[model samples]
Target chain A: AQKVTQAQTEISVVEKEDVTLDCVYETRDTTYYLFWYKQPPSGELVFLIRRNSFDEQNEISGRYSWNFQKSTSSFNFTITASQVVDSAVYFCALSEGTYSSASKIIFGSGTRLSIRP
Target chain B: NAGVTQTPKFRILKIGQSMTLQCTQDMNHNYMYWYRQDPGMGLKLIYYSVGAGITDKGEVPNGYNVSRSTTEDFPLRLELAAPSQTSVYFCASRYTGTDNEQFFGPGTRLTVL
Candidate 1:
């Protein structure tokens, strides 16, 4: 069985604050994929990043960053100086297998982040 | 490119009615999927197609059906509309590669009464 847990249901922070959203996953497969997606008020999902099992490197894109630790089975996302435009719901997902035999993505319940200015 | 597109952005259906949610992608992706998201919840996979003419059930496929006769389109069919089936349906497509991320459609919001 594969599961992705995002315990934070909601988080509110003032503008320019740094916030981190935690994601923990459970999967027996040695090779799997992790993902982060953002859903703004537009009601459409926007893909943020995808990390494979072999890569444990932390990634930074502008004010957003992701820390992937395979040992703890955790992929945490952080936003530096979060602005009002950053208010949205974030989701963490997991999938098993390589390119050919990859399974469907299993998404966590999601965490809604509110950045108030 | 159009990426992935879904029809009828919003729809209201009465109980027992049948409808098909259309999805089309121009990316020439080999894998396509259908997922439903309830209010304030994550997406639950309903069905997926690996290639043309090959379809499989996902985590939740009881109230839905899907077909993949072509690589560019995968449509989900709802046989009998029920209140429990009311949700926002999303269609996604991805190329057969390790680094490729699934491209999602705008999604269809359905309400069953």
Candidate 2:
């Protein structure tokens, strides 16, 4: 079985503040993939990032960064200098199955982040 | 590219009514999926198609049906609509590869009364 938990239901931050959203996952498979997606108020999901199981290295893209720690089964996302445009619901997803078998993904409850400009 | 597209941006259904949500992808992706999002909740997989003539159920497939008769089209069918079934439906598609990144549609908001 595989599960992803996002403890933070909602968070609000003012402009320029840095915010970190926490995500924890559970999976028995040695090979897996982790993903971060953002759903704006318009109700469209936008893919943010994807990381494989073996890659524990941190990733940064402009104002966005992701920290994947296999030891803790945690993949945390951070936003530097947050803006109103960053306000959205972020989800963490996990996939652990053979492509020929079950390659579907399981998603967390999601964390709603509100940024005020 | 149009990527993935879903028809009927919004719809209203009466109890016991049935309707089909249409999805199309021009990306020529081998994998297509249907997910539903409730208010303040993450999307839940309803069904997915690996290729034409191959479809499988996902986490929440009850009360829903899907068919993939063509590579560019996968439509989800809902029988006897219920209030609990009201949600925002999304269609996504991805090419065959290890990367497995999915592109999503704008989503269809369904309201049942």
Candidate 3:
């Protein structure tokens, strides 16, 4: 079974400050997909990013970025110069493969981020 | 186009009552899923269907049932409502591909007393 763990339950940071949310996963499969999703106060799930096992390359999307490290089985997300709009609950998820019997994605407990002024 | 739509955004049910949560997707997705979100917790999959007439149980499928009679509609049924069953439910769909992303609906908030 694949399991995702987001150690930080909640985080607070001042506006325009940088913050990083940690995510660690456990999966026996050699290949799998990792994803990050954001749910704001409006209660809508928004897809942030998706990373596969083979591709450990870091990604930067405007003010958001992700670092995937296979050695530690970690996929961390960082927000640079975060604004008040960035306050939301972030979730880390894992899906094994397309052919896996249970292709259903499993998610972590989530990290609630609060951006203060 | 409405990627995914769930009806009855908010509902209240009494104990022993039953109701169905309607979900529909216009994106022609082959995989559809139902998930529930509890307080301070991540979403847990309740059920999923690969295609029409093919439904399977997910992590937490107790006290709930689902049916996929068409490619566009998947409805979730709660046989007997319980207080513990109160939570927000979300419907999502994904196309047939390895790198596919699941598009989610706004979600239905159900309260049982």
Candidate 4:
């Protein structure tokens, strides 16, 4: 079985503030994939980032960055200079990357981030 | 490309009523999935199909059913509408491979009373 935990249920910050959302995961498979999804008020989930277990290198896409630490089994996402548009429920997800579980994906409860102007 | 699309963007159902939620993708993805999102909760997988005719249940599959008769279409069915079944349903599809990015649909909001 696989599980994802987003400890922070909700967080609020003013615009331009940097916020980091933490994600922890548990999986029996030695290899797996981690993902972050954003669900805005519109109710549609938008895929933010996807990282495989093998690639521990951090990623930076404009204002968004992700830290994947295999040793700690944590994948954290950070939004620098967050804007009001970034306010949304962010979800951390996991999937078995090995052939053991195929492509079953599991999601965490989610963290509602609010960026006020 | 239309990516992924769902029908009846919103629907209201009476107790015990039945309906099917439609999902289609133009990307020719081999893996399709059905997930339901509740208020303040992450999306829960209900069912998935690797290809046409191959379907499997996911974490929360009690009140729903799904069928994948064609590569481009996967439909989810709710046999007996209940308030507990009310949620926002999302359809997603991904290419045939491990750890691939899944494209999501706009979602369908269903209310049961």
Candidate 5:
């Protein structure tokens, strides 16, 4: 079974400040995919990023970035100079792939981020 | 492209009543999923289909049922409504592959009184 854990239930930061969301996962599969999704107040989930176990390279997308570490089984997301629009619930998910449809994805509890101006 | 569409954005059902949540994807994806989000919690998978005519139970699939008769549609049905089943439901789909990203629908908010 694959399980994802997002320790922080809620986080608050002032606008333009930097914030990091922590995500740790547990999976026995040798190969799997990790994903980050954002759900704003509108209640629609927006796909943020996806990283696989083989690639631990850190990624930076404009104001958003992700650090994938295999040794520690952690995939953390960071926001640089976050704005009010960044306020949303962020989720970490894991999926095992073996070219079979039986492999299902699991999600964490989620971290609710509040950006205040 | 109307990526993933879910019908009945908001619904309220009485106890013992039943309803179906409709989901359709135009992306020609082979994988579709149904998930429910409770208060202060992440989404829990209810059911998923890898392709048409193939459906499987997910983590929390006890109260719900799903059928995939076509590649484009996956509908979730609640047999007997209960207060515990009241939550926001989201439908998503992804192409068959390891790196394919899952596209999500706006979501359906269901309330059972």
Candidate 6:
């Protein structure tokens, strides 16, 4: 069974503050893929990043960063200098990377981030 | 490129009514998926198709049916609309490759009453 857990239901922070969204996953598959998506007030899902199980290297894109730690089974996302535009719901997802079952992705409940100016 | 597109951005269905959520992708991807998201929640996969003819159920498929007659289109059908089936429906597609990153549609908001 593959599962993704995002314990923080909602978080509110002032603009320019740094916020981290925690994501923990449980998957027995040795080869799996993890992802983070952003859903803004517009209600469209935006793909943020995708990290494979083999790649534990952290990634940074502008103010958004992802920390993928295989040892902890966690893929945490952080927004540095969070801006009002960064306010959105973040979701963590897991997918079996094998050829047979790679089409399915299991998503976390989600974490809503509210940025206040 | 149109990426992925869904029809009827918003719809209201009465109990026991039926409708199909249409999805089309211009990318010619081999894998297509249908997922539903409840308010303030993550997405739950309802069905997926690896190709034009292969389709399978995902995590939540109780109230939905899907058909994949062509690689560019995958439509989800609701046989009998129920309140529990009301959610935002998203369609996605990805090339059959190592990345497995799915491109999503704008989504269809469905309400059942």
Best by TM-score: 1
Instruction: List, residue by residue over A10-55, the lDDT tens digit for candidate 5.
Output: 9999999999999999999898889999999988998999898899
- In candidate 2, position A17 carries an lDDT of 100
TM-score of chain A for each candidate?
0.98, 0.96, 0.96, 0.95, 0.96, 0.96
Return whichever of 1 and 2 wins on DockQ. 1
How far off is residue B7 in model 3, in Å?
0.6
| Native A-B contact fraction in model 2 | 0.42
Query: Compared with the true structure, what per-residue lDDT tens digits does model 1 show for residues A1-22?
Result: 9999999999999999999999
Model 2: how far is B5 from its true place, Å? 0.3
Q: Write the per-residue lDDT of candidate 3 for residues B1-97, one digit (tens) a residue.
A: 9899999999999999999999999988889999999989999999999999999999999999999999999999999899999999999998876
lDDT string, candidate 6, B1-113, tens digits: 98999999999999999999999999989899999999878999999999988999888989899999998899999998999998999999988764879999999999999
DockQ of each model vs. true complex: 0.72, 0.58, 0.59, 0.59, 0.62, 0.65
> Candidate 2: RMSD over Cα atoms?
1.1
Off by over 4 Å in 3: A99-102
Error of 6 at A12 (Å): 0.4
> Chain B of candidate 6 versus the native chain B: what TM-score?
0.98
Off by over 4 Å in 4: A99-101
Interface DockQ of candidate 2: 0.58
Cα deviation in Å at residue B86, candidate 5? 0.4
Candidate 5, B7-37: lDDT as tens digits: 9999999999999999999999899999999
- CA deviation > 4 Å runs, candidate 1: B98-100
Kept native contacts, as fractions per model, are: 0.68, 0.42, 0.50, 0.57, 0.55, 0.57
Q: Where is model 2 more than 4 Å wrong at Cα? A: A98-102
Docking class of 5: medium
Best by the lDDT measure: 1
Considering chain A alone, report the TM-score of candidate 3 relative to the true chain A: 0.96
User: Cα lDDT of all candidates, in order?
Assistant: 0.95, 0.92, 0.94, 0.92, 0.92, 0.92
Show the lowest summed lDDT stretch of 10 residues, model 3 chain A: A95-104
Candidate 2 overall lDDT versus native? 0.92
